[model samples]
Target: MSSGIPYTWDTDCIRASATCRAEGRLGKGTKHHPLEIQSTTTKKVVYLSDSGSSSLHTVGERMDWKRLTLVFCWLECASAAGISCRNEQGQAVDWYILYKQPSINDENGLVYLYMDESTGGWVPAHNPIDDQKSALAQTLLPLFQHFTNETINFGYILYNDQPPEPFKTASSSFGHSKGLVMMDQETGIWLSHSTPHFPGFDITGFWPNSGYANGQTFICGTYKYSAFRNIAVQLQYIHVYSFDAYIPEYFYPELQCVVDKGCYPKKTPWDRQLNMTSLGGHSFISYAKYSRYHDDLYSGLLDKHLESAFYAKSWGRLLDPLPSNCSVDFSVYNVETVQLPTTEPYSITKDHSKWCVTMDSKLHRWTCIADMNREVSQEHRGGGAICTDNAAVWSAFLDIVNTYQPCQS
Candidate 1:
């Protein structure tokens, strides 16, 4: 009944024990040593060595071997609870980034590279998409648990232009964007991603293989509860897939639209632009363009601040339109090919990811990850981008621009 640091089993030892048990050799000989288990629930180290002894071990004589075994089983079940993306270690992280490579890479396109504070740059993830160890799984797993476990009280919204089927049929004039927001009383996370029909439907509780076909991107940031206010203002510009507010007492009036399953009914869809600082202190400017504004976000909204031409990718040529020419000073071009560091060049057609960067490096290092593309059909779509001036992030994205098609004068 006491609460403290949860017990963590040695993953290696656990695997070894499982293997022994499978081979029917566990506890067979004196040479087999007791499995070592550590409990951090107490202030001091409490070692429990399961050696198959008949004598009952006791903690303060009040808790016997039988009680300990039951407690251990409960702990195991609790630790195994939640969705795939829960923080397994229960450690707080500033932020994490994921880049899902296209299937063209030979491996399952679902495989992705992740970057965190511990990792200076991108590292190939060791776990698969479904594995709890994977960054995506750990980050998103909590959402599943929040819905399934009533004991977990939180608020969340899953919004995407193309939401999961059945639910997708219910919407009308939703924005062209994809993102998710989930939070408790203390802190929360806002995940901005570029995949559709993702994280699966409520009934399925699974990750869809359909999202793995083309390249995709996801940026997750942990933030204080106050940050959700700014996030709510921004979501007004995007589409809502499926939204549920468990703690209605904590809901803001603006956020209630999500709960109502309706878009704001305003003649002039309000477009907003603002600076957002993540819990990690990373600076990002959000450009939220509502559907009422019929213009390309890059050329009409961001070109002035960026002060340089851009190369963006939308859908393929069949649906793609001419690149937008800047009315002010710079132009926005269509990206034809994308080449990432240490990766082969690939056509934009193969990339469902939507992002762009300033062509000239001298202009304040700008890289943007947006939800909508430059296709003609998207001009009036509600969507936005999270842009950063960080040199490292900008350089990482800038270096991948292989070629672009300039707008005709």
Candidate 2:
């Protein structure tokens, strides 16, 4: 479809453009010609007034009207939809990552760490919910408003093993998955997270305080309509959610089972393996649990002869871990203390981040973020992981392994 407006700027110009866009006074420009303001005056100073207005002042100097106009257009579009994750052109992007840090010494509460290709690395978010410039808020605010905006015309499914209080008893066989999906005919996003009892009902605009007690992570990816077909496959493997909500009008035949039977049919043959490509150009492999493939993700991968190591919260079934076979080295990740590349050292417990890394230095490094733990009880449950071999993602996750408990022989 249309890529929207074409404008690019550095960090400083981006901030200024965001301000201009939020105020809604950016002049017009088209793809054929760049933005240009024909002014004879020399040095002109454009600044925002305390009342939040953009004003231009002329001095005895030359100024770049074309550059200024581009900035204005860029920021205007960026601010048009409120605070949202942005691309290099200061336009909204399709995917983003948000990490919630636990309340540590001197830290106030939940701190949001945001990242997109434009920003490259993680940046601290000023506000997670209301900040108009925040990627997380930008991506989520629309979904929150969808509850009241009937004309918005989008399809959504919100699932959590521990759902909001109203619909807790809906499904007991669902895997321990927490996520939400919102889409239309063209594009949409899938937000996979580790927080329980979250995004609260349409009425509650606040995050549950309990989520702040430990470290949590969320990954949101925007994808073309075609990608949802693969997503639907993954959801089928997840079985069901503790609580789920979907609109029948948006259901494709593949996903109609969710709306009709409350879950996929018991006998429906589904692919146990899938490769999902995100809009951001990231690739992930999803492994589903079914009939002969009853083994856990690590063991299943091991059976294929892929050697790897895993890191997960050890509270559930730490003692009954899968042994390290000749090809795979499975282990439990311990985080008594964590030192990450982007943040300071902090202690955490009950961290729900499920991920693993291949340890074979000779082989291509592989990293996977999953929805299930390594506990014995979870072996029987249906869940999956999205794996990638991106080095940056690998480095970011690898640096956090302070210690691990190796599997017994």
Candidate 3:
């Protein structure tokens, strides 16, 4: 995996395309031949011609051959139906984080910094954050292109605190989280972001105008299909306000309840924690809390679970932001200023991103991207955090903390 390289989109297949339904083969037999085929038959198998022609010659038991083809088609469809996180270059990545800078000092907020496993530190984005070729847009290409596909193989759920037009008001008790989950039966991407009304219900110009003023962050990871079961269960704890969702009726029975209004929890466990593994084998921990929890996310939950002091960065426009606290075993401080490697330092007032990292890199290097803000009102809201201890990810976040407020007492 390398950065600063132009991606060639011509070599890749159209992900989740209904026209490319898994039959015996799926792909245009162009120069390199990206088609994947597997069939058990007595007839001799022939490779697709370089002229982009589908050719097959075989003679055997008619009914048996048809049965074998149908069986293979099912297998092929499952294997070919993949939805993963794509990078700026249109290449698949295990995970990536984007930090969109605040539009201060006569600059548009479209400027952002990008980091992934390959990039040791934050790299200045080559294009505007909302551009089609940017990392976020490329990763969402599948959702934008196939949202209305008639195939039952695709599934998605778009949730946010501030929904799109006609339904902008969100429930006060719902989670403050904002993100979208989209995927096929094989694999999918879980993108957790800190922008309001982003990638809205309508596909036309997904980015919202309100997001241009404050800084925001996005963390995306690709996970296997089975992992969504745990993820779906956790979303219930978060009590997400899903603005738009398309959960296929027959496929992914575990996800059906997510969009089902009747299935929303009334009184159950206030919170839940689950461990998940990405398709690339990276481990992540999801910590979710319901409104019934009635506590601050970082000091009351994360600090105790991880047993490490934290420097949290959250939206600074709150009416009464919680100050740094040293009352707990693991103290939690508020980040006041941020300085990215490629950008000038800015106050938290210009940023709305919610994230935190361990104060000491020696003992604990946990980094979390969450939706909860350190404030009085948010204490009663349902929200959650996704955390990882990956060294690269930790370092990238740790390096951005330029200043923070210490315990006042």
Candidate 4:
């Protein structure tokens, strides 16, 4: 995780990429096996020559769309079944969030509260969190069912701080993040969660045994193909540690780096902010910081940009956690206790989830599900946050801040 070789994006490169997308030069697709990919291994894959190069060619030849009309037709036909976030009933949804409750004395912690645009607030899960027909299972059905098949219409990347067995632990400076990015040539979904060593390279049994203990959170959003390119650029700043990926030739050039487990920043101003719009037109802001940028991601960065005081809940069991800070323009407090409906209050130490919510929902109403903890060790790590101002999402997080540590006198 040492700093990457310096790379720069000039104005010409930006214009070339914009033109490439505008012309729909994304190439033909291919199928891949996730468990077999190695970051160090080089594959004979197609890549757009530096950003300044505009022509899209594969294997040193210009594409003939007329001869490849069949491929285009297949993509259009498959786009109808593109990947997306699903609700508890296995229906496609614009966005959704699940708060898996922790196990108590008589409970096994299988139950969770589900929320989406349709579910005004939070609704009790129809099935257990790990059940096959659950929302997560249904959402991933395409990847699980089609991965081994020869279909080349879709691609996916699974990344996490604590990946499945055999994958070595990421460098301490890498982002403390866990999530999956899946998509077709047309649309896709980005799922951000706080679970570790979960939903591994395997196709079935989406949840792992360790995921049943502590409370966790997941946010899933559906976006068009162009947005995935933006997401790939943001991951470069986050320095994501991707354990498994299947990037077809049809994917945008920005995503090719994921196949090699690369997200090292290419230039100075090692941080980036972007407004990504979902297919349904919901607005979300992504914030990313490279590992070399030393600062507290929440108090020192996000709070001021969001222009609001925050109540943050992160892994409190770690050593040397940052105390609440009020000296800055926007104060950031540490959440101490969380209480959900029908459950007793629990200490933040038992939760490994990382998220922050605006202190005043009436004014800001912002909630961010992010990577990185409010601990001294994570201050130097590369990480990012996905934030939204949707009322339902904002209320769900704000309600969880039952108690927090105020700045000392």
Candidate 5:
């Protein structure tokens, strides 16, 4: 029911591990952001709070609920079981996690995470993924859809010693990173993808140790790829992985596929092409939503919802064909100017995925799993390398957007 300025509410939870599956009691514990603003002007997110603690107990005690609509926060994990270990001294054996790794919503319509197995001392007791109340939300009272949960296998991919041309289907077309799903499916050769989707994750968990903790990016609409952006995200480099990689966050409602109950949620990767015609843009579809994501959609740097890295078919490099040709060209379709990526200060570029808000347009900056770890995110090269000639937005744009609608009871 709350909108404008700052969204305030009463508080938080923790994950059993990196995934959203709550390890401990998903209880109604603490809170974050007495003043949380998703700045419409600067488009830059700014969070102002006096508390710098991960104690859900303490956060809930001091939260002012009249301020915001949602409360987003992060907690540190101790093991694959996602439990923070109390040492012989009855305290969590402290590890230095720097950043507050963000929990994200993604196009898949499922909230996924690969908890870094290195965060805590390996306690062989249990696996956090199945823990009823993950570290996420404390109160185990079934809160319906606070988050969609799923476990992911974040591990290594061995490039075949002998190179083959590329097989389209051989590629992991779903949660794509650029290892090489097959340069040309027709040729059966691998292109060699090196984005975040390739490398394995910690499963133990990362964050809240050495970096800044700003879990405020959890808005109502988005998709979560992997949270390991804080880890190594370089295409040129090998073994690029994440503590957790956060990809395209979607707003649950945008997904148009329906269920037996007659709800139109989106489909997963396996059946994506079979139902390719159903793939469209945001809920606000004025004209045909066209992009390289499919034969029909082509939204180039259109909005926050569309700007993403290259296709999974290629390994994080520019999706081949140099200039992708969307099925609809200017002459055939009734294409009018909706929202242009160039109108906002948002940035964009070749390699990496994130962009900064610029003067006129959203210029994308090349980023990878590494940008999440390093402080300095490099500026993208100008014209030569990066081009959106005939590109499309995210394939799961609608699905990711649908995950956030208040889940039904």
Candidate 6:
């Protein structure tokens, strides 16, 4: 593996991918998938981004809501979604997906950490009256309507996921007003990690929602949620981030690792550490393997929830109907049980065909491309996941991850 890529993958994927390239079917990107964490400080935070140009550019705490209005005016949307990251050259980038404000309600909400004395910026959410979603599609969506060829296949949700009261501080970065916490502007990384990805207000525990050691985990995998074939194309770098803010993935009733801690959830067989996603059907399959706790391998039965956490959130809250100014195709879901062949080997879909979207095994919790349209109908089970499917998005995400793999020394 090369130093540029962030994680490792199953040997079989590596071999088959190598074979594909050898057969003139595909080219290669980074090899080693280096684990990266860009240095962040008062001056800069390399790994996160949001609506504000800077991580500190929030609605108000000690400052004014000037910047939010500015973006609201230009981007023309109130609800929006975004990410903060550094490109390959280590340049900080704030990428956002927003919508034009609706005529009836053009105001985007500022999720302040507090009720008064502070306000986070008004994040953008597309307005169906002007912007496009289903029609325009992701890759087809241009970076700028005014003038730019950059595509928007990856920017999906764009709204303020604020924290609720009793949680508000009024003077903190992402100043508390409602139930919301982006990477704290004061702390550096933009919002989005502290809370689990629940439909509304899942950040009851902390801030920097997806940061390391929050009794949560981050899983990465290519999606098979929408269209099967389109997602499979980007098989090399699918990442599904799972956070256990709700409960540690490895909790067990009989395992001694599960200790009583009334102050917190039971002490796990393992203590607080970062989490990962196996992308395999751990939730659906029994006795699979997984990765967790500073990247250690764990039994799937020990922490099935870790690999299965993504399904806990509702896709309805995160997904927006296709807007006009946008050219992006999206799909994501989860279910309790399944109707798909229990015996069929996991595979990635190709040419509109259904295949198993298996999780990468070599790496602990992992991500990979899989079949999307492949629907194994279930009679009485439920789970969920959200994914954006587009060859362009798949390509763009890989490029973005490669470019944003963080500077790990």
The candidate scoring highest on TM-score is 3
How would you encode candidate 3's per-residue C-alpha lDDT over 1-409 as one tens digit per residue? 1222111111122432222332212322223333333333233222344453333333332233343343333232333345878777666788888999998885868998898878887889898887866888777766765654544578898888887676676879678888888878778989998998788533347788787888999989999988898898788788788888888876576577767633445776688899999998988999998888888999888987777888999898899898998999998999999987766788999999999999777878899999889998888888889998988888889889999999986
Tens-place lDDT digits, model 2, residues 348-397: 45355666666545565666666666656667666666666666566566
Better of 3 and 5 by lDDT: 3
Candidate 1 per-residue lDDT, tens place, 10-93, comes to: 222233312221222211111123223333342111343344232222334444445444434323333433221233233346
lDDT of each: 0.62, 0.55, 0.75, 0.73, 0.20, 0.19
Q: Order of all candidates by TM-score, from best down to worst? A: 3, 4, 1, 2, 5, 6
What are the per-residue Cα lDDT tens digits for candidate 4 across 101-202?
A: 887763758788888888777888888989866788767766675554535777888888888777877877668788888888778999988888867543
Off by over 4 Å in 3: 1-81, 201-204, 264-268
Backbone clash count, each prediction separately: 4, 9, 0, 0, 133, 97
Local accuracy of candidate 6 as per-residue lDDT tens digits, 1-409: 2234222111112222122111222212232221121111111111112222321222224324453333221121111111122121112222211111111121321111110001121222232211222111211121121023222222222111132332322221111001111121111111122222222221122223222211111112211223212221111011112111221223222111111111212223322222221123112111111112222112112223333211111111222311111111111122111111111121111011111121222323322221111121210111112222222222322221211111122
Which of the two candidates, 3 or 4, achieves a greater lDDT against the reference?
Answer: 3
Candidate order by decreasing lDDT? 3, 4, 1, 2, 5, 6
Model 1: ten consecutive residues of lowest lDDT: 22-31
> TM-score for each prediction?
0.76, 0.71, 0.81, 0.79, 0.21, 0.18
Residue pairs with clashing backbones, model 3: none
Better of 1 and 5 by TM-score: 1
Where does candidate 1 clash, by residue pair? 84-137, 85-137, 85-138, 85-141
> Per-residue error at 103 for model 2, in Å?
2.4
